[model samples]
Structure formats: structure tokens, C-alpha cells
Target: MKELICISCPMGCHLQVEGESVENIVVSGNGCVRGIIYAKNEITAPKRMVCGTVKINGATQPVVSVKTKEPIPKEKIFDCLAELNNTTIEAPVSVGDVAIVNVCNTGVDVVVTKGLSKR
Candidate 1:
């Protein structure tokens, strides 16, 4: 059995899950249907949105903001960050430009969140 707080909504439902595996898990204390799905996925394979800064060359700012185009496996966050931290992009980057493609083989792209003009 496991206890978790549902983040699917602002209600923050306290949930109780029980089962040997994700296939048989049961959830309770959910205020809505979304909570059940959230609990199930949270237990089986959790994902998270990643946001960070990467170095920018020939730009007014030393760094630019970036985020994954889609949620990535929770376990791969550190690897993703490490890759991002080691990356350097040229100036005049535009928002929505792909910073890294297929990051960590998760089939997700890291995109620029803030555009930077050339210095």
C-alpha cells in the first residue's frame, strides 16, 4: 500500500494505492476521475515537465530559459539537466526553437522558452 497526494488538481486529494503492480493497483480518496488516473500513472511511470537554463554564446544574456516540449520520465530528469547544462547555443535564438532533439532518447525535444538577440 502507498499514500500519495494527488496533484492533478488544486483540491490535492489524499490518495491511497494498493497492489503488487501497476496493472492491479487500486486508488481511493480521489475527488474526481482525473485523480485516479494521476495516481495510477504516478505509481507506474511518473513524468515531469523540465525547465532550466542553458549557456548562450554571443547573446546579451549569458543564459536562456528552456523546457522540454513534453513531459519526460522522472528518472531521466538529471540526465536531461546534465545535457542541458553542458550545452551552448548560438545567439539570436527564437522561442520555440529546438534546443535539443530526442533528448536522452525519450523522444522529447528541449525548446527555447525565451528568445535572445545577438550581442
Candidate 2:
């Protein structure tokens, strides 16, 4: 059995999952159907949205904020960050622009969160 707090809603229902494997898992204490799905997926294959800053060249700011277009596999987060850390983009970037494509081969793009003009 495992205990988790539901993040699917603001209610934050405490959940308990019991099973030997993902297929046989049973979830309880969820107030909504969404919470049950969340718990199951979280336990079997957790994912997370990554947000961070990347260095910019000749930009007004030293770095620009960015985020993954979709949640990535939890384990690949650090690898994704490593790629971002080693990257540098030119100025005149706009919001929603792809900073990195198919990051970590997860088929997710890293996009700029804020526009940055040339210095």
C-alpha cells in the first residue's frame, strides 16, 4: 500500500493505493475520478512539467524563462535540464518560440515563456 496526496484538484484528497503492480492497483479516498487516474499514473509512470531559464546571447536579459510544452518522464528531467544548461539562444526570441525541439527525445518541445528583444 502507498499513500499520496491528490493534486488533481484543490481539495487535496489523501489517497491510498494497494496492489502488487500497476495493473492490479486499487486507489481509494479520491473525491473525484480525476484523482484516481492521477494517482495511478503517478505511481506507474510519473511525469512533470519542467520550467527553467536558458542563457541568451546578446539579449536584454542574461537568460530567458522556458518550459516544456508537455510533461516529461520524471527521470528525464535532469537530462533535459542538462541540455538546457548547455544551450544558448540568440536574442529577439518571442514567447511561444521553440527553444529546443523533441527535448531528450521525449517528443516534447521546450518553449520560451517570455519574449526577449535584442540588446
Candidate 3:
């Protein structure tokens, strides 16, 4: 059995999961149905949203905030960050502009979260 805290909502239900796979697991201590799904996904292919800042040339700010357009595989978080760390973009970037396409081959783009104007 594995103990986990459900992050599906603000409730943060403590969960106890048993079994090796989603097909045969038993989950307890979830406060809502979303917790069940969260547990299942968490035990299987966990994913997370990646966010950080990247260097920007000619921008009023030296860096721009960025995030994954979608949740990426948890295992790829560091790889994604590495790619973003090495990335430098031009200024005049707007919020929602793609900074890196298919980042880490996860089929998720890294988008600008904060707009930056040319200096």
C-alpha cells in the first residue's frame, strides 16, 4: 500500500492506495471523485505543469516568465527546464507566444506567461 495526499482540490485528502496498477488498486481517504482520478493518474503516468523564466534579448526585462502550454510528464520536468534554461528569445514577446515548440519532444510548447517589450 502507498500513502498519498490528493492534490485534486484544495481539500488535500489523505489517500491510501493498494495494488500495483490502476486496474487493481484500492484507494481510500479521498474526499471527492476527482481524488480517485487524481490517484489513478498519479500512480500511473504522472504529469505536471512546468513554469520558469527564460533569457530575453532587448526586452525591458532581462527575462520572461514561461510555462508549458499543457501538463508534461513528471519525468521530463528537469529536461524541459534544461531546454528552457538554454533558451533565449527576442524581445517584444507577448503573453501566450510560443517560446519553445514541442519542448523536450513532449508535444508541449513553452509559452510566454508575461509579455515583454523591446527596450
Candidate 4:
């Protein structure tokens, strides 16, 4: 058996996962449906949701926080971040504006977290 702390919810369930069969995997203290799914995946293949900054044009700040519209494969996160770091966008950026599209071929776009106004 392997122990895991569920990060999907604030409750952070203490769980035990083992074996390939779902019936053989013993889970305890999960707070919600999402936690169950999270724990199952975490045991098989852990993943993450990443958020970071990207350069913004004509804004008071040099950059803005951008995140994928949907979670991408964890392996591509660094490459996505690096790609975003290398790119810049014009100002008047909406809060949900797409800063980088099709990042790392994960079929996800990094979007602005907040509005960026023109100088």
C-alpha cells in the first residue's frame, strides 16, 4: 500500500492506494468525488495544474499571471512556461485573454489572470 494526501480539496484526505484492480485499492478520508479521482490518478500518474507569468505589452507591469484554460499534461508545463517566458503580447489584455495558444501541443492556451491596460 502507498499513502497519499489528496490535494484536490482543502480537506486533504489521507489515502492508501495499492494494486492494479480498483477493488484492491483502499481509499479513506476523501472529501469529495474529485478527491477520489485525484487520488486514483495521483497513484497511477501524478499530474499538476500550473500557473505563471507572461510578458505583457504597454502595461504598467512587465508581466501578468497566465494559466491554462484547462490543465495540461504535467510533463509539458515547464516547456509551456519557458515558451511563455520567451513570448510577449500587446496591451489592453482582458482578464481571460489568450496569451499563448496551443502551448507545448497540450491543446491548452495560457490565459491572462487579470486585465492589463494600455499605457
Q: Against the true structure, what is every candidate's RMSD?
A: 1.7, 1.6, 1.4, 1.8
- Ten residues in sequence with the least summed lDDT for candidate 4: 17-26
Itemize residue pairs with steric clashes in candidate 4.
none
Best-fitting candidate, measured by TM-score?
3
Candidate 2 residue runs with Cα over 4 Å from true position? 20-22
- lDDT string for model 3 (65-104, tens) is 9999998999999999999999999999999999999999
TM-score (all chains, Cα) for each model: 0.87, 0.89, 0.90, 0.88
Q: Could you give me the TM-score of model 3 versus the true structure? A: 0.90
Candidate 2 or 3, higher TM-score? 3
Judged by whole-model lDDT over C-alpha atoms, candidate 2 comes out at 0.92
Per-residue lDDT tens digits of candidate 4, residues 1-119?
A: 77788887677788766665555666666667776787677766667777989888898899888888887777777898799889899888888988888888888778889897898
User: What is the lDDT of every predicted structure here?
Assistant: 0.92, 0.92, 0.92, 0.79
The Cα RMSD in angstroms, rounded to one decimal, for candidate 1 relative to the true structure is 1.7
Q: Which portions of model 3 show Cα errors greater than 4 Å?
A: none
Better of 1 and 2 by TM-score: 2
TM-score for candidate 4, residues paired by index: 0.88
TM-score of 1: 0.87
